[model samples]
Target chain A: DVKVTQSSRYLVKRTGEKVFLECVQDMDHENMFWYRQDPGLGLRLIYFSYDVKMKEKGDIPEGYSVSREKKERFSLILESASTNQTSMYLCASSLTGTSGYNEQFFGPGTRLTVL
Target chain B: AQSVAQPEDQVNVAEGNPLTVKCTYSVSGNPYLFWYVQYPNRGLQFLLKYITGDNLVKGSYGFEAEFNKSQTSFHLKKPSALVSDSALYFCAVRDTGTGGFKTIFGAGTRLFVKA
Candidate 1:
């Protein structure tokens, strides 16, 4: 079974602090994505990495960044935690080719609360 | 623009009754539709997908979705609604002819299964 795990299930950070959310997938998927979900706003993509050390900005990547130094691990970084940045952060991994395009395996989300 | 839409924000159903969550897509080429479920405090989980061939697609947790090309809709349905099935559902579509592995997701629909 495909398993995606996140470093923390819940996190609280002070304003202006740096925050890091880690995600790892057991399956050897090449695509990893970070998304922030808010009420009524759904899931907004923050960043996605197609390969190690390669990254691309999504719809809302302003105050957030991501890293993919290893195949199985992807990390999302909050440059300066703000109350507006608080949301349910989700990590997902999927295969690269068309055959595995639509289905994404997601980890349990990390709910971030900035104070 | 290629996009997916879930018109209804919420759907309510009584236990043991049938339920349906509506989804629609507007994209170029053939559309690959998918359904995902998110339990409270959890990340989204892949429920089912319609790639090709059959219009009816079955997925985990006794859920299934029907892809209708004429209606540009892929509504998720289950014969019997269970209280445990209450969750946030998302509809997504993979853009086929856009020359990328981009998937557009609906805002999401909350399903309330009443016992």
Candidate 2:
């Protein structure tokens, strides 16, 4: 079975503070993603990395950045935490293939609260 | 652009009754649809997917989805409902013909099963 793990399950930060959320997948997948889930908005992609040292912006990537220094680890960085950034953060990974029909395995989300 | 829509915000059903969660999608080309379930404080778990071939695709935990090309829908269904099945459900889609790794998710539907 594939397993994805996050660094923190719950976090609280003050406004304008830098926050880091880490994700690691044991399946050695080539694609990793970061998303913020909110009520009524669902899951909006923040950023994704297809390979080590490669990153791409998603629908809502503002005020967020990503790092993929290694294949197993992907980190989401909040430049300056704001109240609007308070939400559940999810990470997912999938194997690379010709068809983009691969199932993405997810981690047990990180709920961040910005004060 | 590809997009997915979950018409219902929530669905309530009694145990042993049939349950259905509606999901519709739009894409310029061939679509790769998927269904996922999320428990409280957990990330989304892959339930099933529709790539090609069979219109009715069976998935995990007795869940299944039927793909309707004319209607552009991929609705998730189950024979009977259980209290353990209560969770948030999301539908996702990606344009395989467009050749991008981005997958768009619906707003999500909360399933409530009463014993």
Candidate 3:
């Protein structure tokens, strides 16, 4: 089975603290994405990496950053955690081309709470 | 600009009743539409997608969606709703203008299936 595993299922952090949420996919997909899910707002994309060391900002990338040093792993970084940043973070991976062939496989998600 | 809309914030249905979750999208170029389900405390899972040929797309968990190109809608449907099917549903459309790597998601609709 294509698997995407997150480093933490739940995380709590203090305001102004630096946080890292890791994600790894066994599928070796070429594209990876990070998103934050909030009530009523649904899922908002934060960042997308099409290849190693390449990234694109999504609709809501203001308070987040991402790193993809390797093909199977992607990491999300919160430079300065704020109470408003507390939300469900999700990571997903998909195959190379975007021509309707990409089916994103997602991790279980990391529920982060900023205190 | 590309966008997705799930007009209803919540949908209530009884067990064994047919359920429909409405979705509409606006995007430049051909629209690659998708539907996802998120269970409590879990990440979103791809339910179905509409790319080309057939208008009706069958997906996992006895769910399906019909693609209406002329109407710019792709609504999710299930013949017999199960109590376990209660969850959050999201609609997404791939942004071709943004190189098709970014997917715009709807605000999501909470599904409540009463026994």
Inter-residue clash pairs, candidate 3: none
Can you tell me which runs of candidate 3 are displaced by over 4 Å? Answer: A97-101
Model 1 agreement with the true structure over A53-108: per-residue lDDT tens digits: 98988879999988999999999999989999989999999987657574889999
Query: At residue B98, what lDDT does model 2 achieve?
Result: 30
Q: Candidate 2 docking: what grade?
A: medium
**Which pairs of residues clash in candidate 1, taking residues 3 or more apart in a chain or in different chains?**
none
Candidate 1 per-residue lDDT, tens place, B1-113, comes to: 78889999999999999999999999888788889999987778999999899999999999999999999999999999999999999999885653355567899999999
Fill in the DockQ of model 1. Answer: 0.70
- The global C-alpha lDDT for each of the candidates, from Candidate 1 onward, is 0.90, 0.92, 0.91
Arrange candidates by lDDT, descending.
Answer: 2, 3, 1
Ranking by DockQ: 2, 3, 1
Model 1 off-target regions past 4 Å?
A97-100, B96-99
For candidate 1, the per-residue lDDT at A103 reads 83
- Tens digits of per-residue lDDT, candidate 3, B2-51, equal 78999999999999999999999998888888999999878889998888
Best by DockQ: 2
User: What's model 3's lDDT at B76?
Assistant: 98
Q: Rank the candidates by TM-score, best first.
A: 2, 3, 1
The alpha-carbon lDDT assigned to residue B115 of candidate 3 equals 100
